[model samples]
Target: MRSPVEPKSAGAWRSQIPTGKALVPYLLLAPFGCLFAVFIVAPLVYAFYISLFRDTLVGGRQFAGAANYLRVMSDDKFWAGLGNLFLFGIVQVPVMLGLATLLALVLDRGQLYGEALFRLGLFLPYAVPGVIAALIWGYVYGPVFGPFAQLAEAIDVPAPELLSREAMLFSIANIVTWEFLGYYMIIFYAALKAIPPHLLEAALLDGASRWQFVRYIQLPLLRPMILLAIVFSINGTLQLFNEPYLMRVHAPTVIDSSYTPNLYAYSLTTANQQYNYAAAISFVLGAVIACASYLFILVSGRRRRR
Candidate 1:
């Protein structure tokens, strides 16, 4: 039989320990909290405040209420940038996710040879900085000097102009695919690793083929990770800027200042000096991203429940 005094002694010890348990958490969180306040929260508040006014270089600032938001509704460039993002989300996200899942499955199979090497090779590109990746790919797409063009000319085959306006978006998508596929593959691979070994053994005992196991068991279990990857990809596509910006510098005629929402906002602030309009656009973009993220969560939750 347990002594009655044992429980009370344990409770007394717990009570004797400093009441500063919460202090540890606050101390650990202080740096990130301060950074969030300075970088994210402050900027967000400033953007909101700026959005409510119209800045004048010559005259004084004037309160515009929701006029800036209303202006966004009619902005042709804003719609175009959104349309471009929509196209990218539709095309790029599925392809990248699919490829990542396939690679993860292949690598997860124990019988595969050189799995580590293959995994490392696939993930290596993601380690390269985005700006550097863009620059390298941009040079590869260069007409007179790029390796592709040189190869095509060597074989007396016509090289398509990859930097043409019609092909530039696809060109950018290709770069993103190359850079991120490996990184996302690692994510899917980790998810695959988390599945209980007993679950796989049960499926095998039930006479499930590899295809059946993957289709019914593996994919269903991976749904949450897939949903997360899709959300990340959508956000990334909407925030596309660096690749196009670098490509524009390399191939001046291809990407314009209004190539994407970020670039458009940058031009408004830097070139046009319309900081208020830029702030408004920034808020609208953030709101769009938030709404999309919420819709993704809601839809995914419904599917999960079903």
Candidate 2:
């Protein structure tokens, strides 16, 4: 019906132009894509590029291939930091998430007196800046002037040395749990609220007890949120820096420059002037986080299938 030239000249332009809903997804994603590429992707690429080079006074910056990465693999400080995170995560994450889940479920029931006050009180700690929270807790863990120590003295009992080497990990974990528990609880509470009211009503009409309804209906629905929380917790755990870094002031003997991988990377850059090696350490930690998160996703997916 139309000449070939006409199709090429006119139809080509029309075909190239997206119409209506064709552009919706791209339009919706444009802002996030720009920010993600600028902030996340660009920095990651730059870090990885930096990691492949070595900077020294003798030779300046030189391409070292994977020398930095190889060094990182054998670095005892890095491994020890990771081991601390692993220990912190194993004990902290489950307890924190479980408490969050329980609190969210209880709040969602709308049975508690002064529910709004309780929610706000729980979430208030999350609003506090991480640095400020750590500082506050640092003083609380100080044996000299801390309330716990004062109370113990008043009661004629020995004060628990919370910042001692034996308890430093638990002390940091406690701070992290206190800071994040309310955040995760809000997430779970929101997910619970999103469940359709009709389904809950149906369960109630079917003579389902609260425990039975929660076990069969709510828990199943909350799995995706649970998995998301776990992944986030894993990432946060591996990147632990703030609590330990701040606590180092209080427990100088227990917390060192290389207390966590993030702290180690920071110390390398600022204290040792090893920017390239620091970047490598950072990228290595990032890779560890990615692999851990991926493994968790696979496991959760397999469990969901079952």
User: Per-prediction RMSD in angstroms?
Assistant: 7.2, 6.7
Instruction: List model 1 lDDT by residue over 1-306, tens digit each.
Output: 125454456556555544577569778899999999999999999989989999776878999999999999899999898988888779889999999999999888767888889999999999999999999999999898999999999999998789988888789999999999999999999999999999889999999998999999999888888989999898888899889889988667656777789999999999998988899999899889989988988998897788
Q: Return the number of clashes found in candidate 1.
A: 0
Provide the lowest-lDDT 10-residue window in model 1.
1-10
Write one digit per residue (lDDT tens) for candidate 2, span 16-101: 67878989998999999999999999998998999999988899899999999999999999999999999999999999999999
- Cα lDDT of candidate 2 equals 0.93
Candidate 2 Cα errors over 4 Å, as ranges: 1-38
Whole-model alpha-carbon lDDT for candidate 1: 0.89
- Please list the C-alpha lDDT of all candidates, in the order they appear: 0.89, 0.93
Query: What TM-score, to 2 decimals, does candidate 2 have?
Result: 0.88
